[model samples]
Target: MKFLKNKITGITIVLIVILVALSPWIIWHFKPDRHLDVLVFDKTVPQNNYREHKGFIWLLNSFKYTKLNGDKYGLLDYFGFFPEPNYKYKIKPLPKDLSKYDLLYVTDTYGVYDRDFYGTSKNIEGERSQKIYGGTQSSEISSIKSALENSNKSKTLIVEFNSLASPTDTKVQKEMDQLLGLKWSGWIGREFKTLNKNNEEIPRWVFRNYRKQYGKEWNFTGSGYVFVKNDDTLMILEKRKDTTKDMTFKFSPKGQEDFGIKREVGYYYWFDIMEKVNNTESIADYTFFLTESGKDKFKKFGIPTSFPAITESKIKNHITYYFSGDYADKGEFPVVYQAVGLPKINSLLISDYGNTDSFFWKIYAPVMQKILDNTYEKKSSETKTASIN
Candidate 1:
């Protein structure tokens, strides 16, 4: 009897040990909140109403993205503020403690809160109180500055949907300018079209190609864009800011540096262009923001500067990837004209996201991932080493 009793006691002890060994893995695999925290700024795009922008969704649905018991265990399981734990109540201000997260994403353009805050003002009672209003307060910008400043311990990435509105609140714009070393000017319109192959849009850049079946083909050749930088990646759609070198170019059917390949039928329509921030002089030290064309057109509009859509910035352990243009809003905008909202299509301005994919994203996302995946500092022993090489 004593031997049998001892055997039972031994089995119980072994069972408890097994449970203890397996508990963490089980909890993390089945419940992500058990071990992850994240701070995300998901202010609405004000235009992507259908939720067609799948950039965030793609990361979430990825296979083994949140797997535990392996290297993938520490992936972005607790995304910005939404995965409310089983019984935790949602609140306005972020939790006082954010040392637990591995990544912080401030991914939006205009700080739209309760429509009334910006855009078409509306009265959505309950929703307005909850949002971080555009220009909520200088304190909010201070918070973001503090987070990025203090993020020496984690990988921090902030993507401004509309780079112009890094911090939409006017109150915070000054703080943001200091934090990013860049300032919002105004939207620069690009003149490009979606690559509509047959009935399907491939969701990628189709180079400088369009159809002129509806209007005079020669007038719509999109003649102004000249090769400033030989970067084939960003050189696709033309209509770069007017440049002195652009006065003379061999006219071609294909509309490239070389002439006479084939007549590429296209259109000359205005687009919502994003320009480099105001601190063009300081930007060269960090990331060389895009280049301005023949002249600073925005100066006439009060922006005082203009540049193409390309940018990169790094601050201490916190690195920011800026997409000067809003890729989500496909390069499509019917306007009176880019200068002063002249008018296009009609006297009214029409806005829409073209197809399944945005041409800007095709080139921007991969490059951005390459830049953000690595840590970079200013004038360091590693600065000479390329981030992607």
Candidate 2:
């Protein structure tokens, strides 16, 4: 009887140990971490109203391969503030005890809360707020500024959606200038109100007209120029009106040299002429423009345009070109775009966070990988110095 009792006790102890060891994985199976603490401040819960919610969920699930284990990861919804461990609560003032978190993310809806209270311990601030069109309440630029200033512990990455409201009204421009001055790495999200979805022939005609006036091909090469810096590459597509006002020469006849002909030039007229010449709808086209520096960088890499074409070399390098719309549709795992407003924001989050040879591991892994690597490197350097001494 004594022997049987001891055997039962041992089995129970073994089972408990196994359960403890597997607890983290078990909990993670239900709610996995994307190596990020997404604090959604939007008034909508589960972001059901926004189309991007599906894409967001998809993005979250794509990280399952990483299978990172930890309690440090979760989502906080800041609509009606309450601390619910099961459902990441949205608290008004960020908790002072954020030492445990490595990254913090803020989305739309929460722009009204006091950001200064969050105390900036985050490494990334993904801002997708744009000016409220019609009658919507736009995200506050001051809040973005406060969040950036407070997050002094590490570099803060801002993902601004479209044009920030005029700098005169808000301090967003000032904060942006400061960030640029600090040499922080960042990118801007430019959204186009209209897209060219007509047949290829129409696009070709538009291209031809653009080339005749600009002395460049209107295809990928011309379009690519907008993202290129120098080389007189005007890749950006301006509205026909804007382009005519900026690029065309007005004709006037006051002297014999000018002939007896005078013509008033309007921007759209040039586009109309092009369309007539090409037998197409309208010649006026719009395109997103990158900063001069960004364009120059693209030129150096031979990546001239934003069109989605993956070359063999790029594929070898594991570089993938993602179109804004395509990314919104397919990038997220479970499709969160339906819940979040994917159409409203034109942005992409590119990081080697999930890549096998990720930038994060390249930059931070050596610090802890085999303490001997650090020890040996330190000893070897010290020895060389000693020899010199």
Candidate 3:
């Protein structure tokens, strides 16, 4: 009897250990695959590198959203990055009938540039990616409009930064702007940790363009913010002179509740300054903690100290979200997404202060999850109502 009892105790311990070890995967499986008919359009794909939409793809996998192609997650559904024998780089045409898709997520329309294709390190295009497969094509814009119209205002469209920026024809851009009720300021800016050329963070074209325009050498050094207009106008805000602190991305009360964001997060990346038009609501904004000097400089250039980071507009039944920053551009966290608790652990281990991925985990992930969840529930409810009718 004693020997049998001891064996039972050992077996119980082993079983508990196994269960604990498999908990993350088990937890992951319990979450239902929402099976959303999502269409992700990322045109910036160069080679097999999926940096532009990597984080978004991971979210799709995490949410278990079935793409329009019937697969859980695959590059096949993307309108861009399709390589062929004749053309190694070119954005594949979008489908004309997009009404079938429940969600149209445009992560990066910036497209593959010459530098991106050949690689920046090679100096092939002299720092200019030079729009190759980027910018919103007329056909693509038309399809998006068709989708919105055909869906009877039920479709959701989410467009991220650089979608309406330079390289995209003004006429084509105006179509989207008019449709979505947004006005692009024709300027994009980003923060730099250092202006030292040795760091190699500053793009070569920036220096070249600055020199060409001003006919002077690049002399400024140290951390700063750089802004460039569509017409090639360049302005720099050095750290001590312009900004007292780094920018913070904050969500409005409505946004905080809607997106389930707990608090503000550090924002360090490319962001465009935009003015809301046609009753568009600013859901979130980037607050640049600028010095008096910085304020004057921005004012002189007709730039606002604080600009909309995320904007939302509702057209009839259709809802649109414009993320004025490169929101979806981030490194993929494979293991972090696989396990349930890994994200929390990872967040605790790393400092969110300067880290870019922290924003993905803290702000982007939860918000995206909420969007997917709400959309799934709403769609499911509509289906049930339709069946009953």
Which model scores highest in TM-score? 3
TM-score of each: 0.43, 0.29, 0.90
Which sections of candidate 2 miss by over 4 Å? 1-37, 40-57, 61-139, 148-171, 180-233, 236-389
Candidate-wise lDDT, in order: 0.36, 0.28, 0.79
Q: Pick the candidate with the highest lDDT.
A: 3
Clashes (candidate 1): 11
Across 1-389, the per-residue lDDT of candidate 1 in tens digits comes to: 99999999999999999987766445435543211133455444333331213343232222112222233332133222222233222324434445444445555434444333333323322122434333224555556656666754544555554423423455465455566556544333333332223212221222232222222222324333311111222222223334322111111222222111221112122222333454422211111112363344333333322333334455665555444434433333322111211111122222122321333223323333333333222212233454544
Question: Which of 1 and 2 is ahead in lDDT?
Answer: 1
CA lDDT, candidate 3, residue 114? 64
In candidate 1, residue 335 scores what lDDT?
23
Tens-digit lDDT track of model 3 for 1-389:
99999999999999999999999889887875667888889887765657777788877886677755556786556877654443365556778889788788898887766665665433442377466667888888888887887675266889888789877899988888887788888899988888876656677888889999889999887888889999999989998788887888989877877876657778888999888887998888888888898988888889988888888888667788888888788755665465665555556675667868777777777777777777787788788888899
Per-residue lDDT tens digits for candidate 2, residues 268-363, read: 110100001111111112222345555554465444223211010111111111111111212123233222222212222323222212211221
lDDT of 1: 0.36
lDDT for residue 20 in candidate 3, whole number 0-100: 96
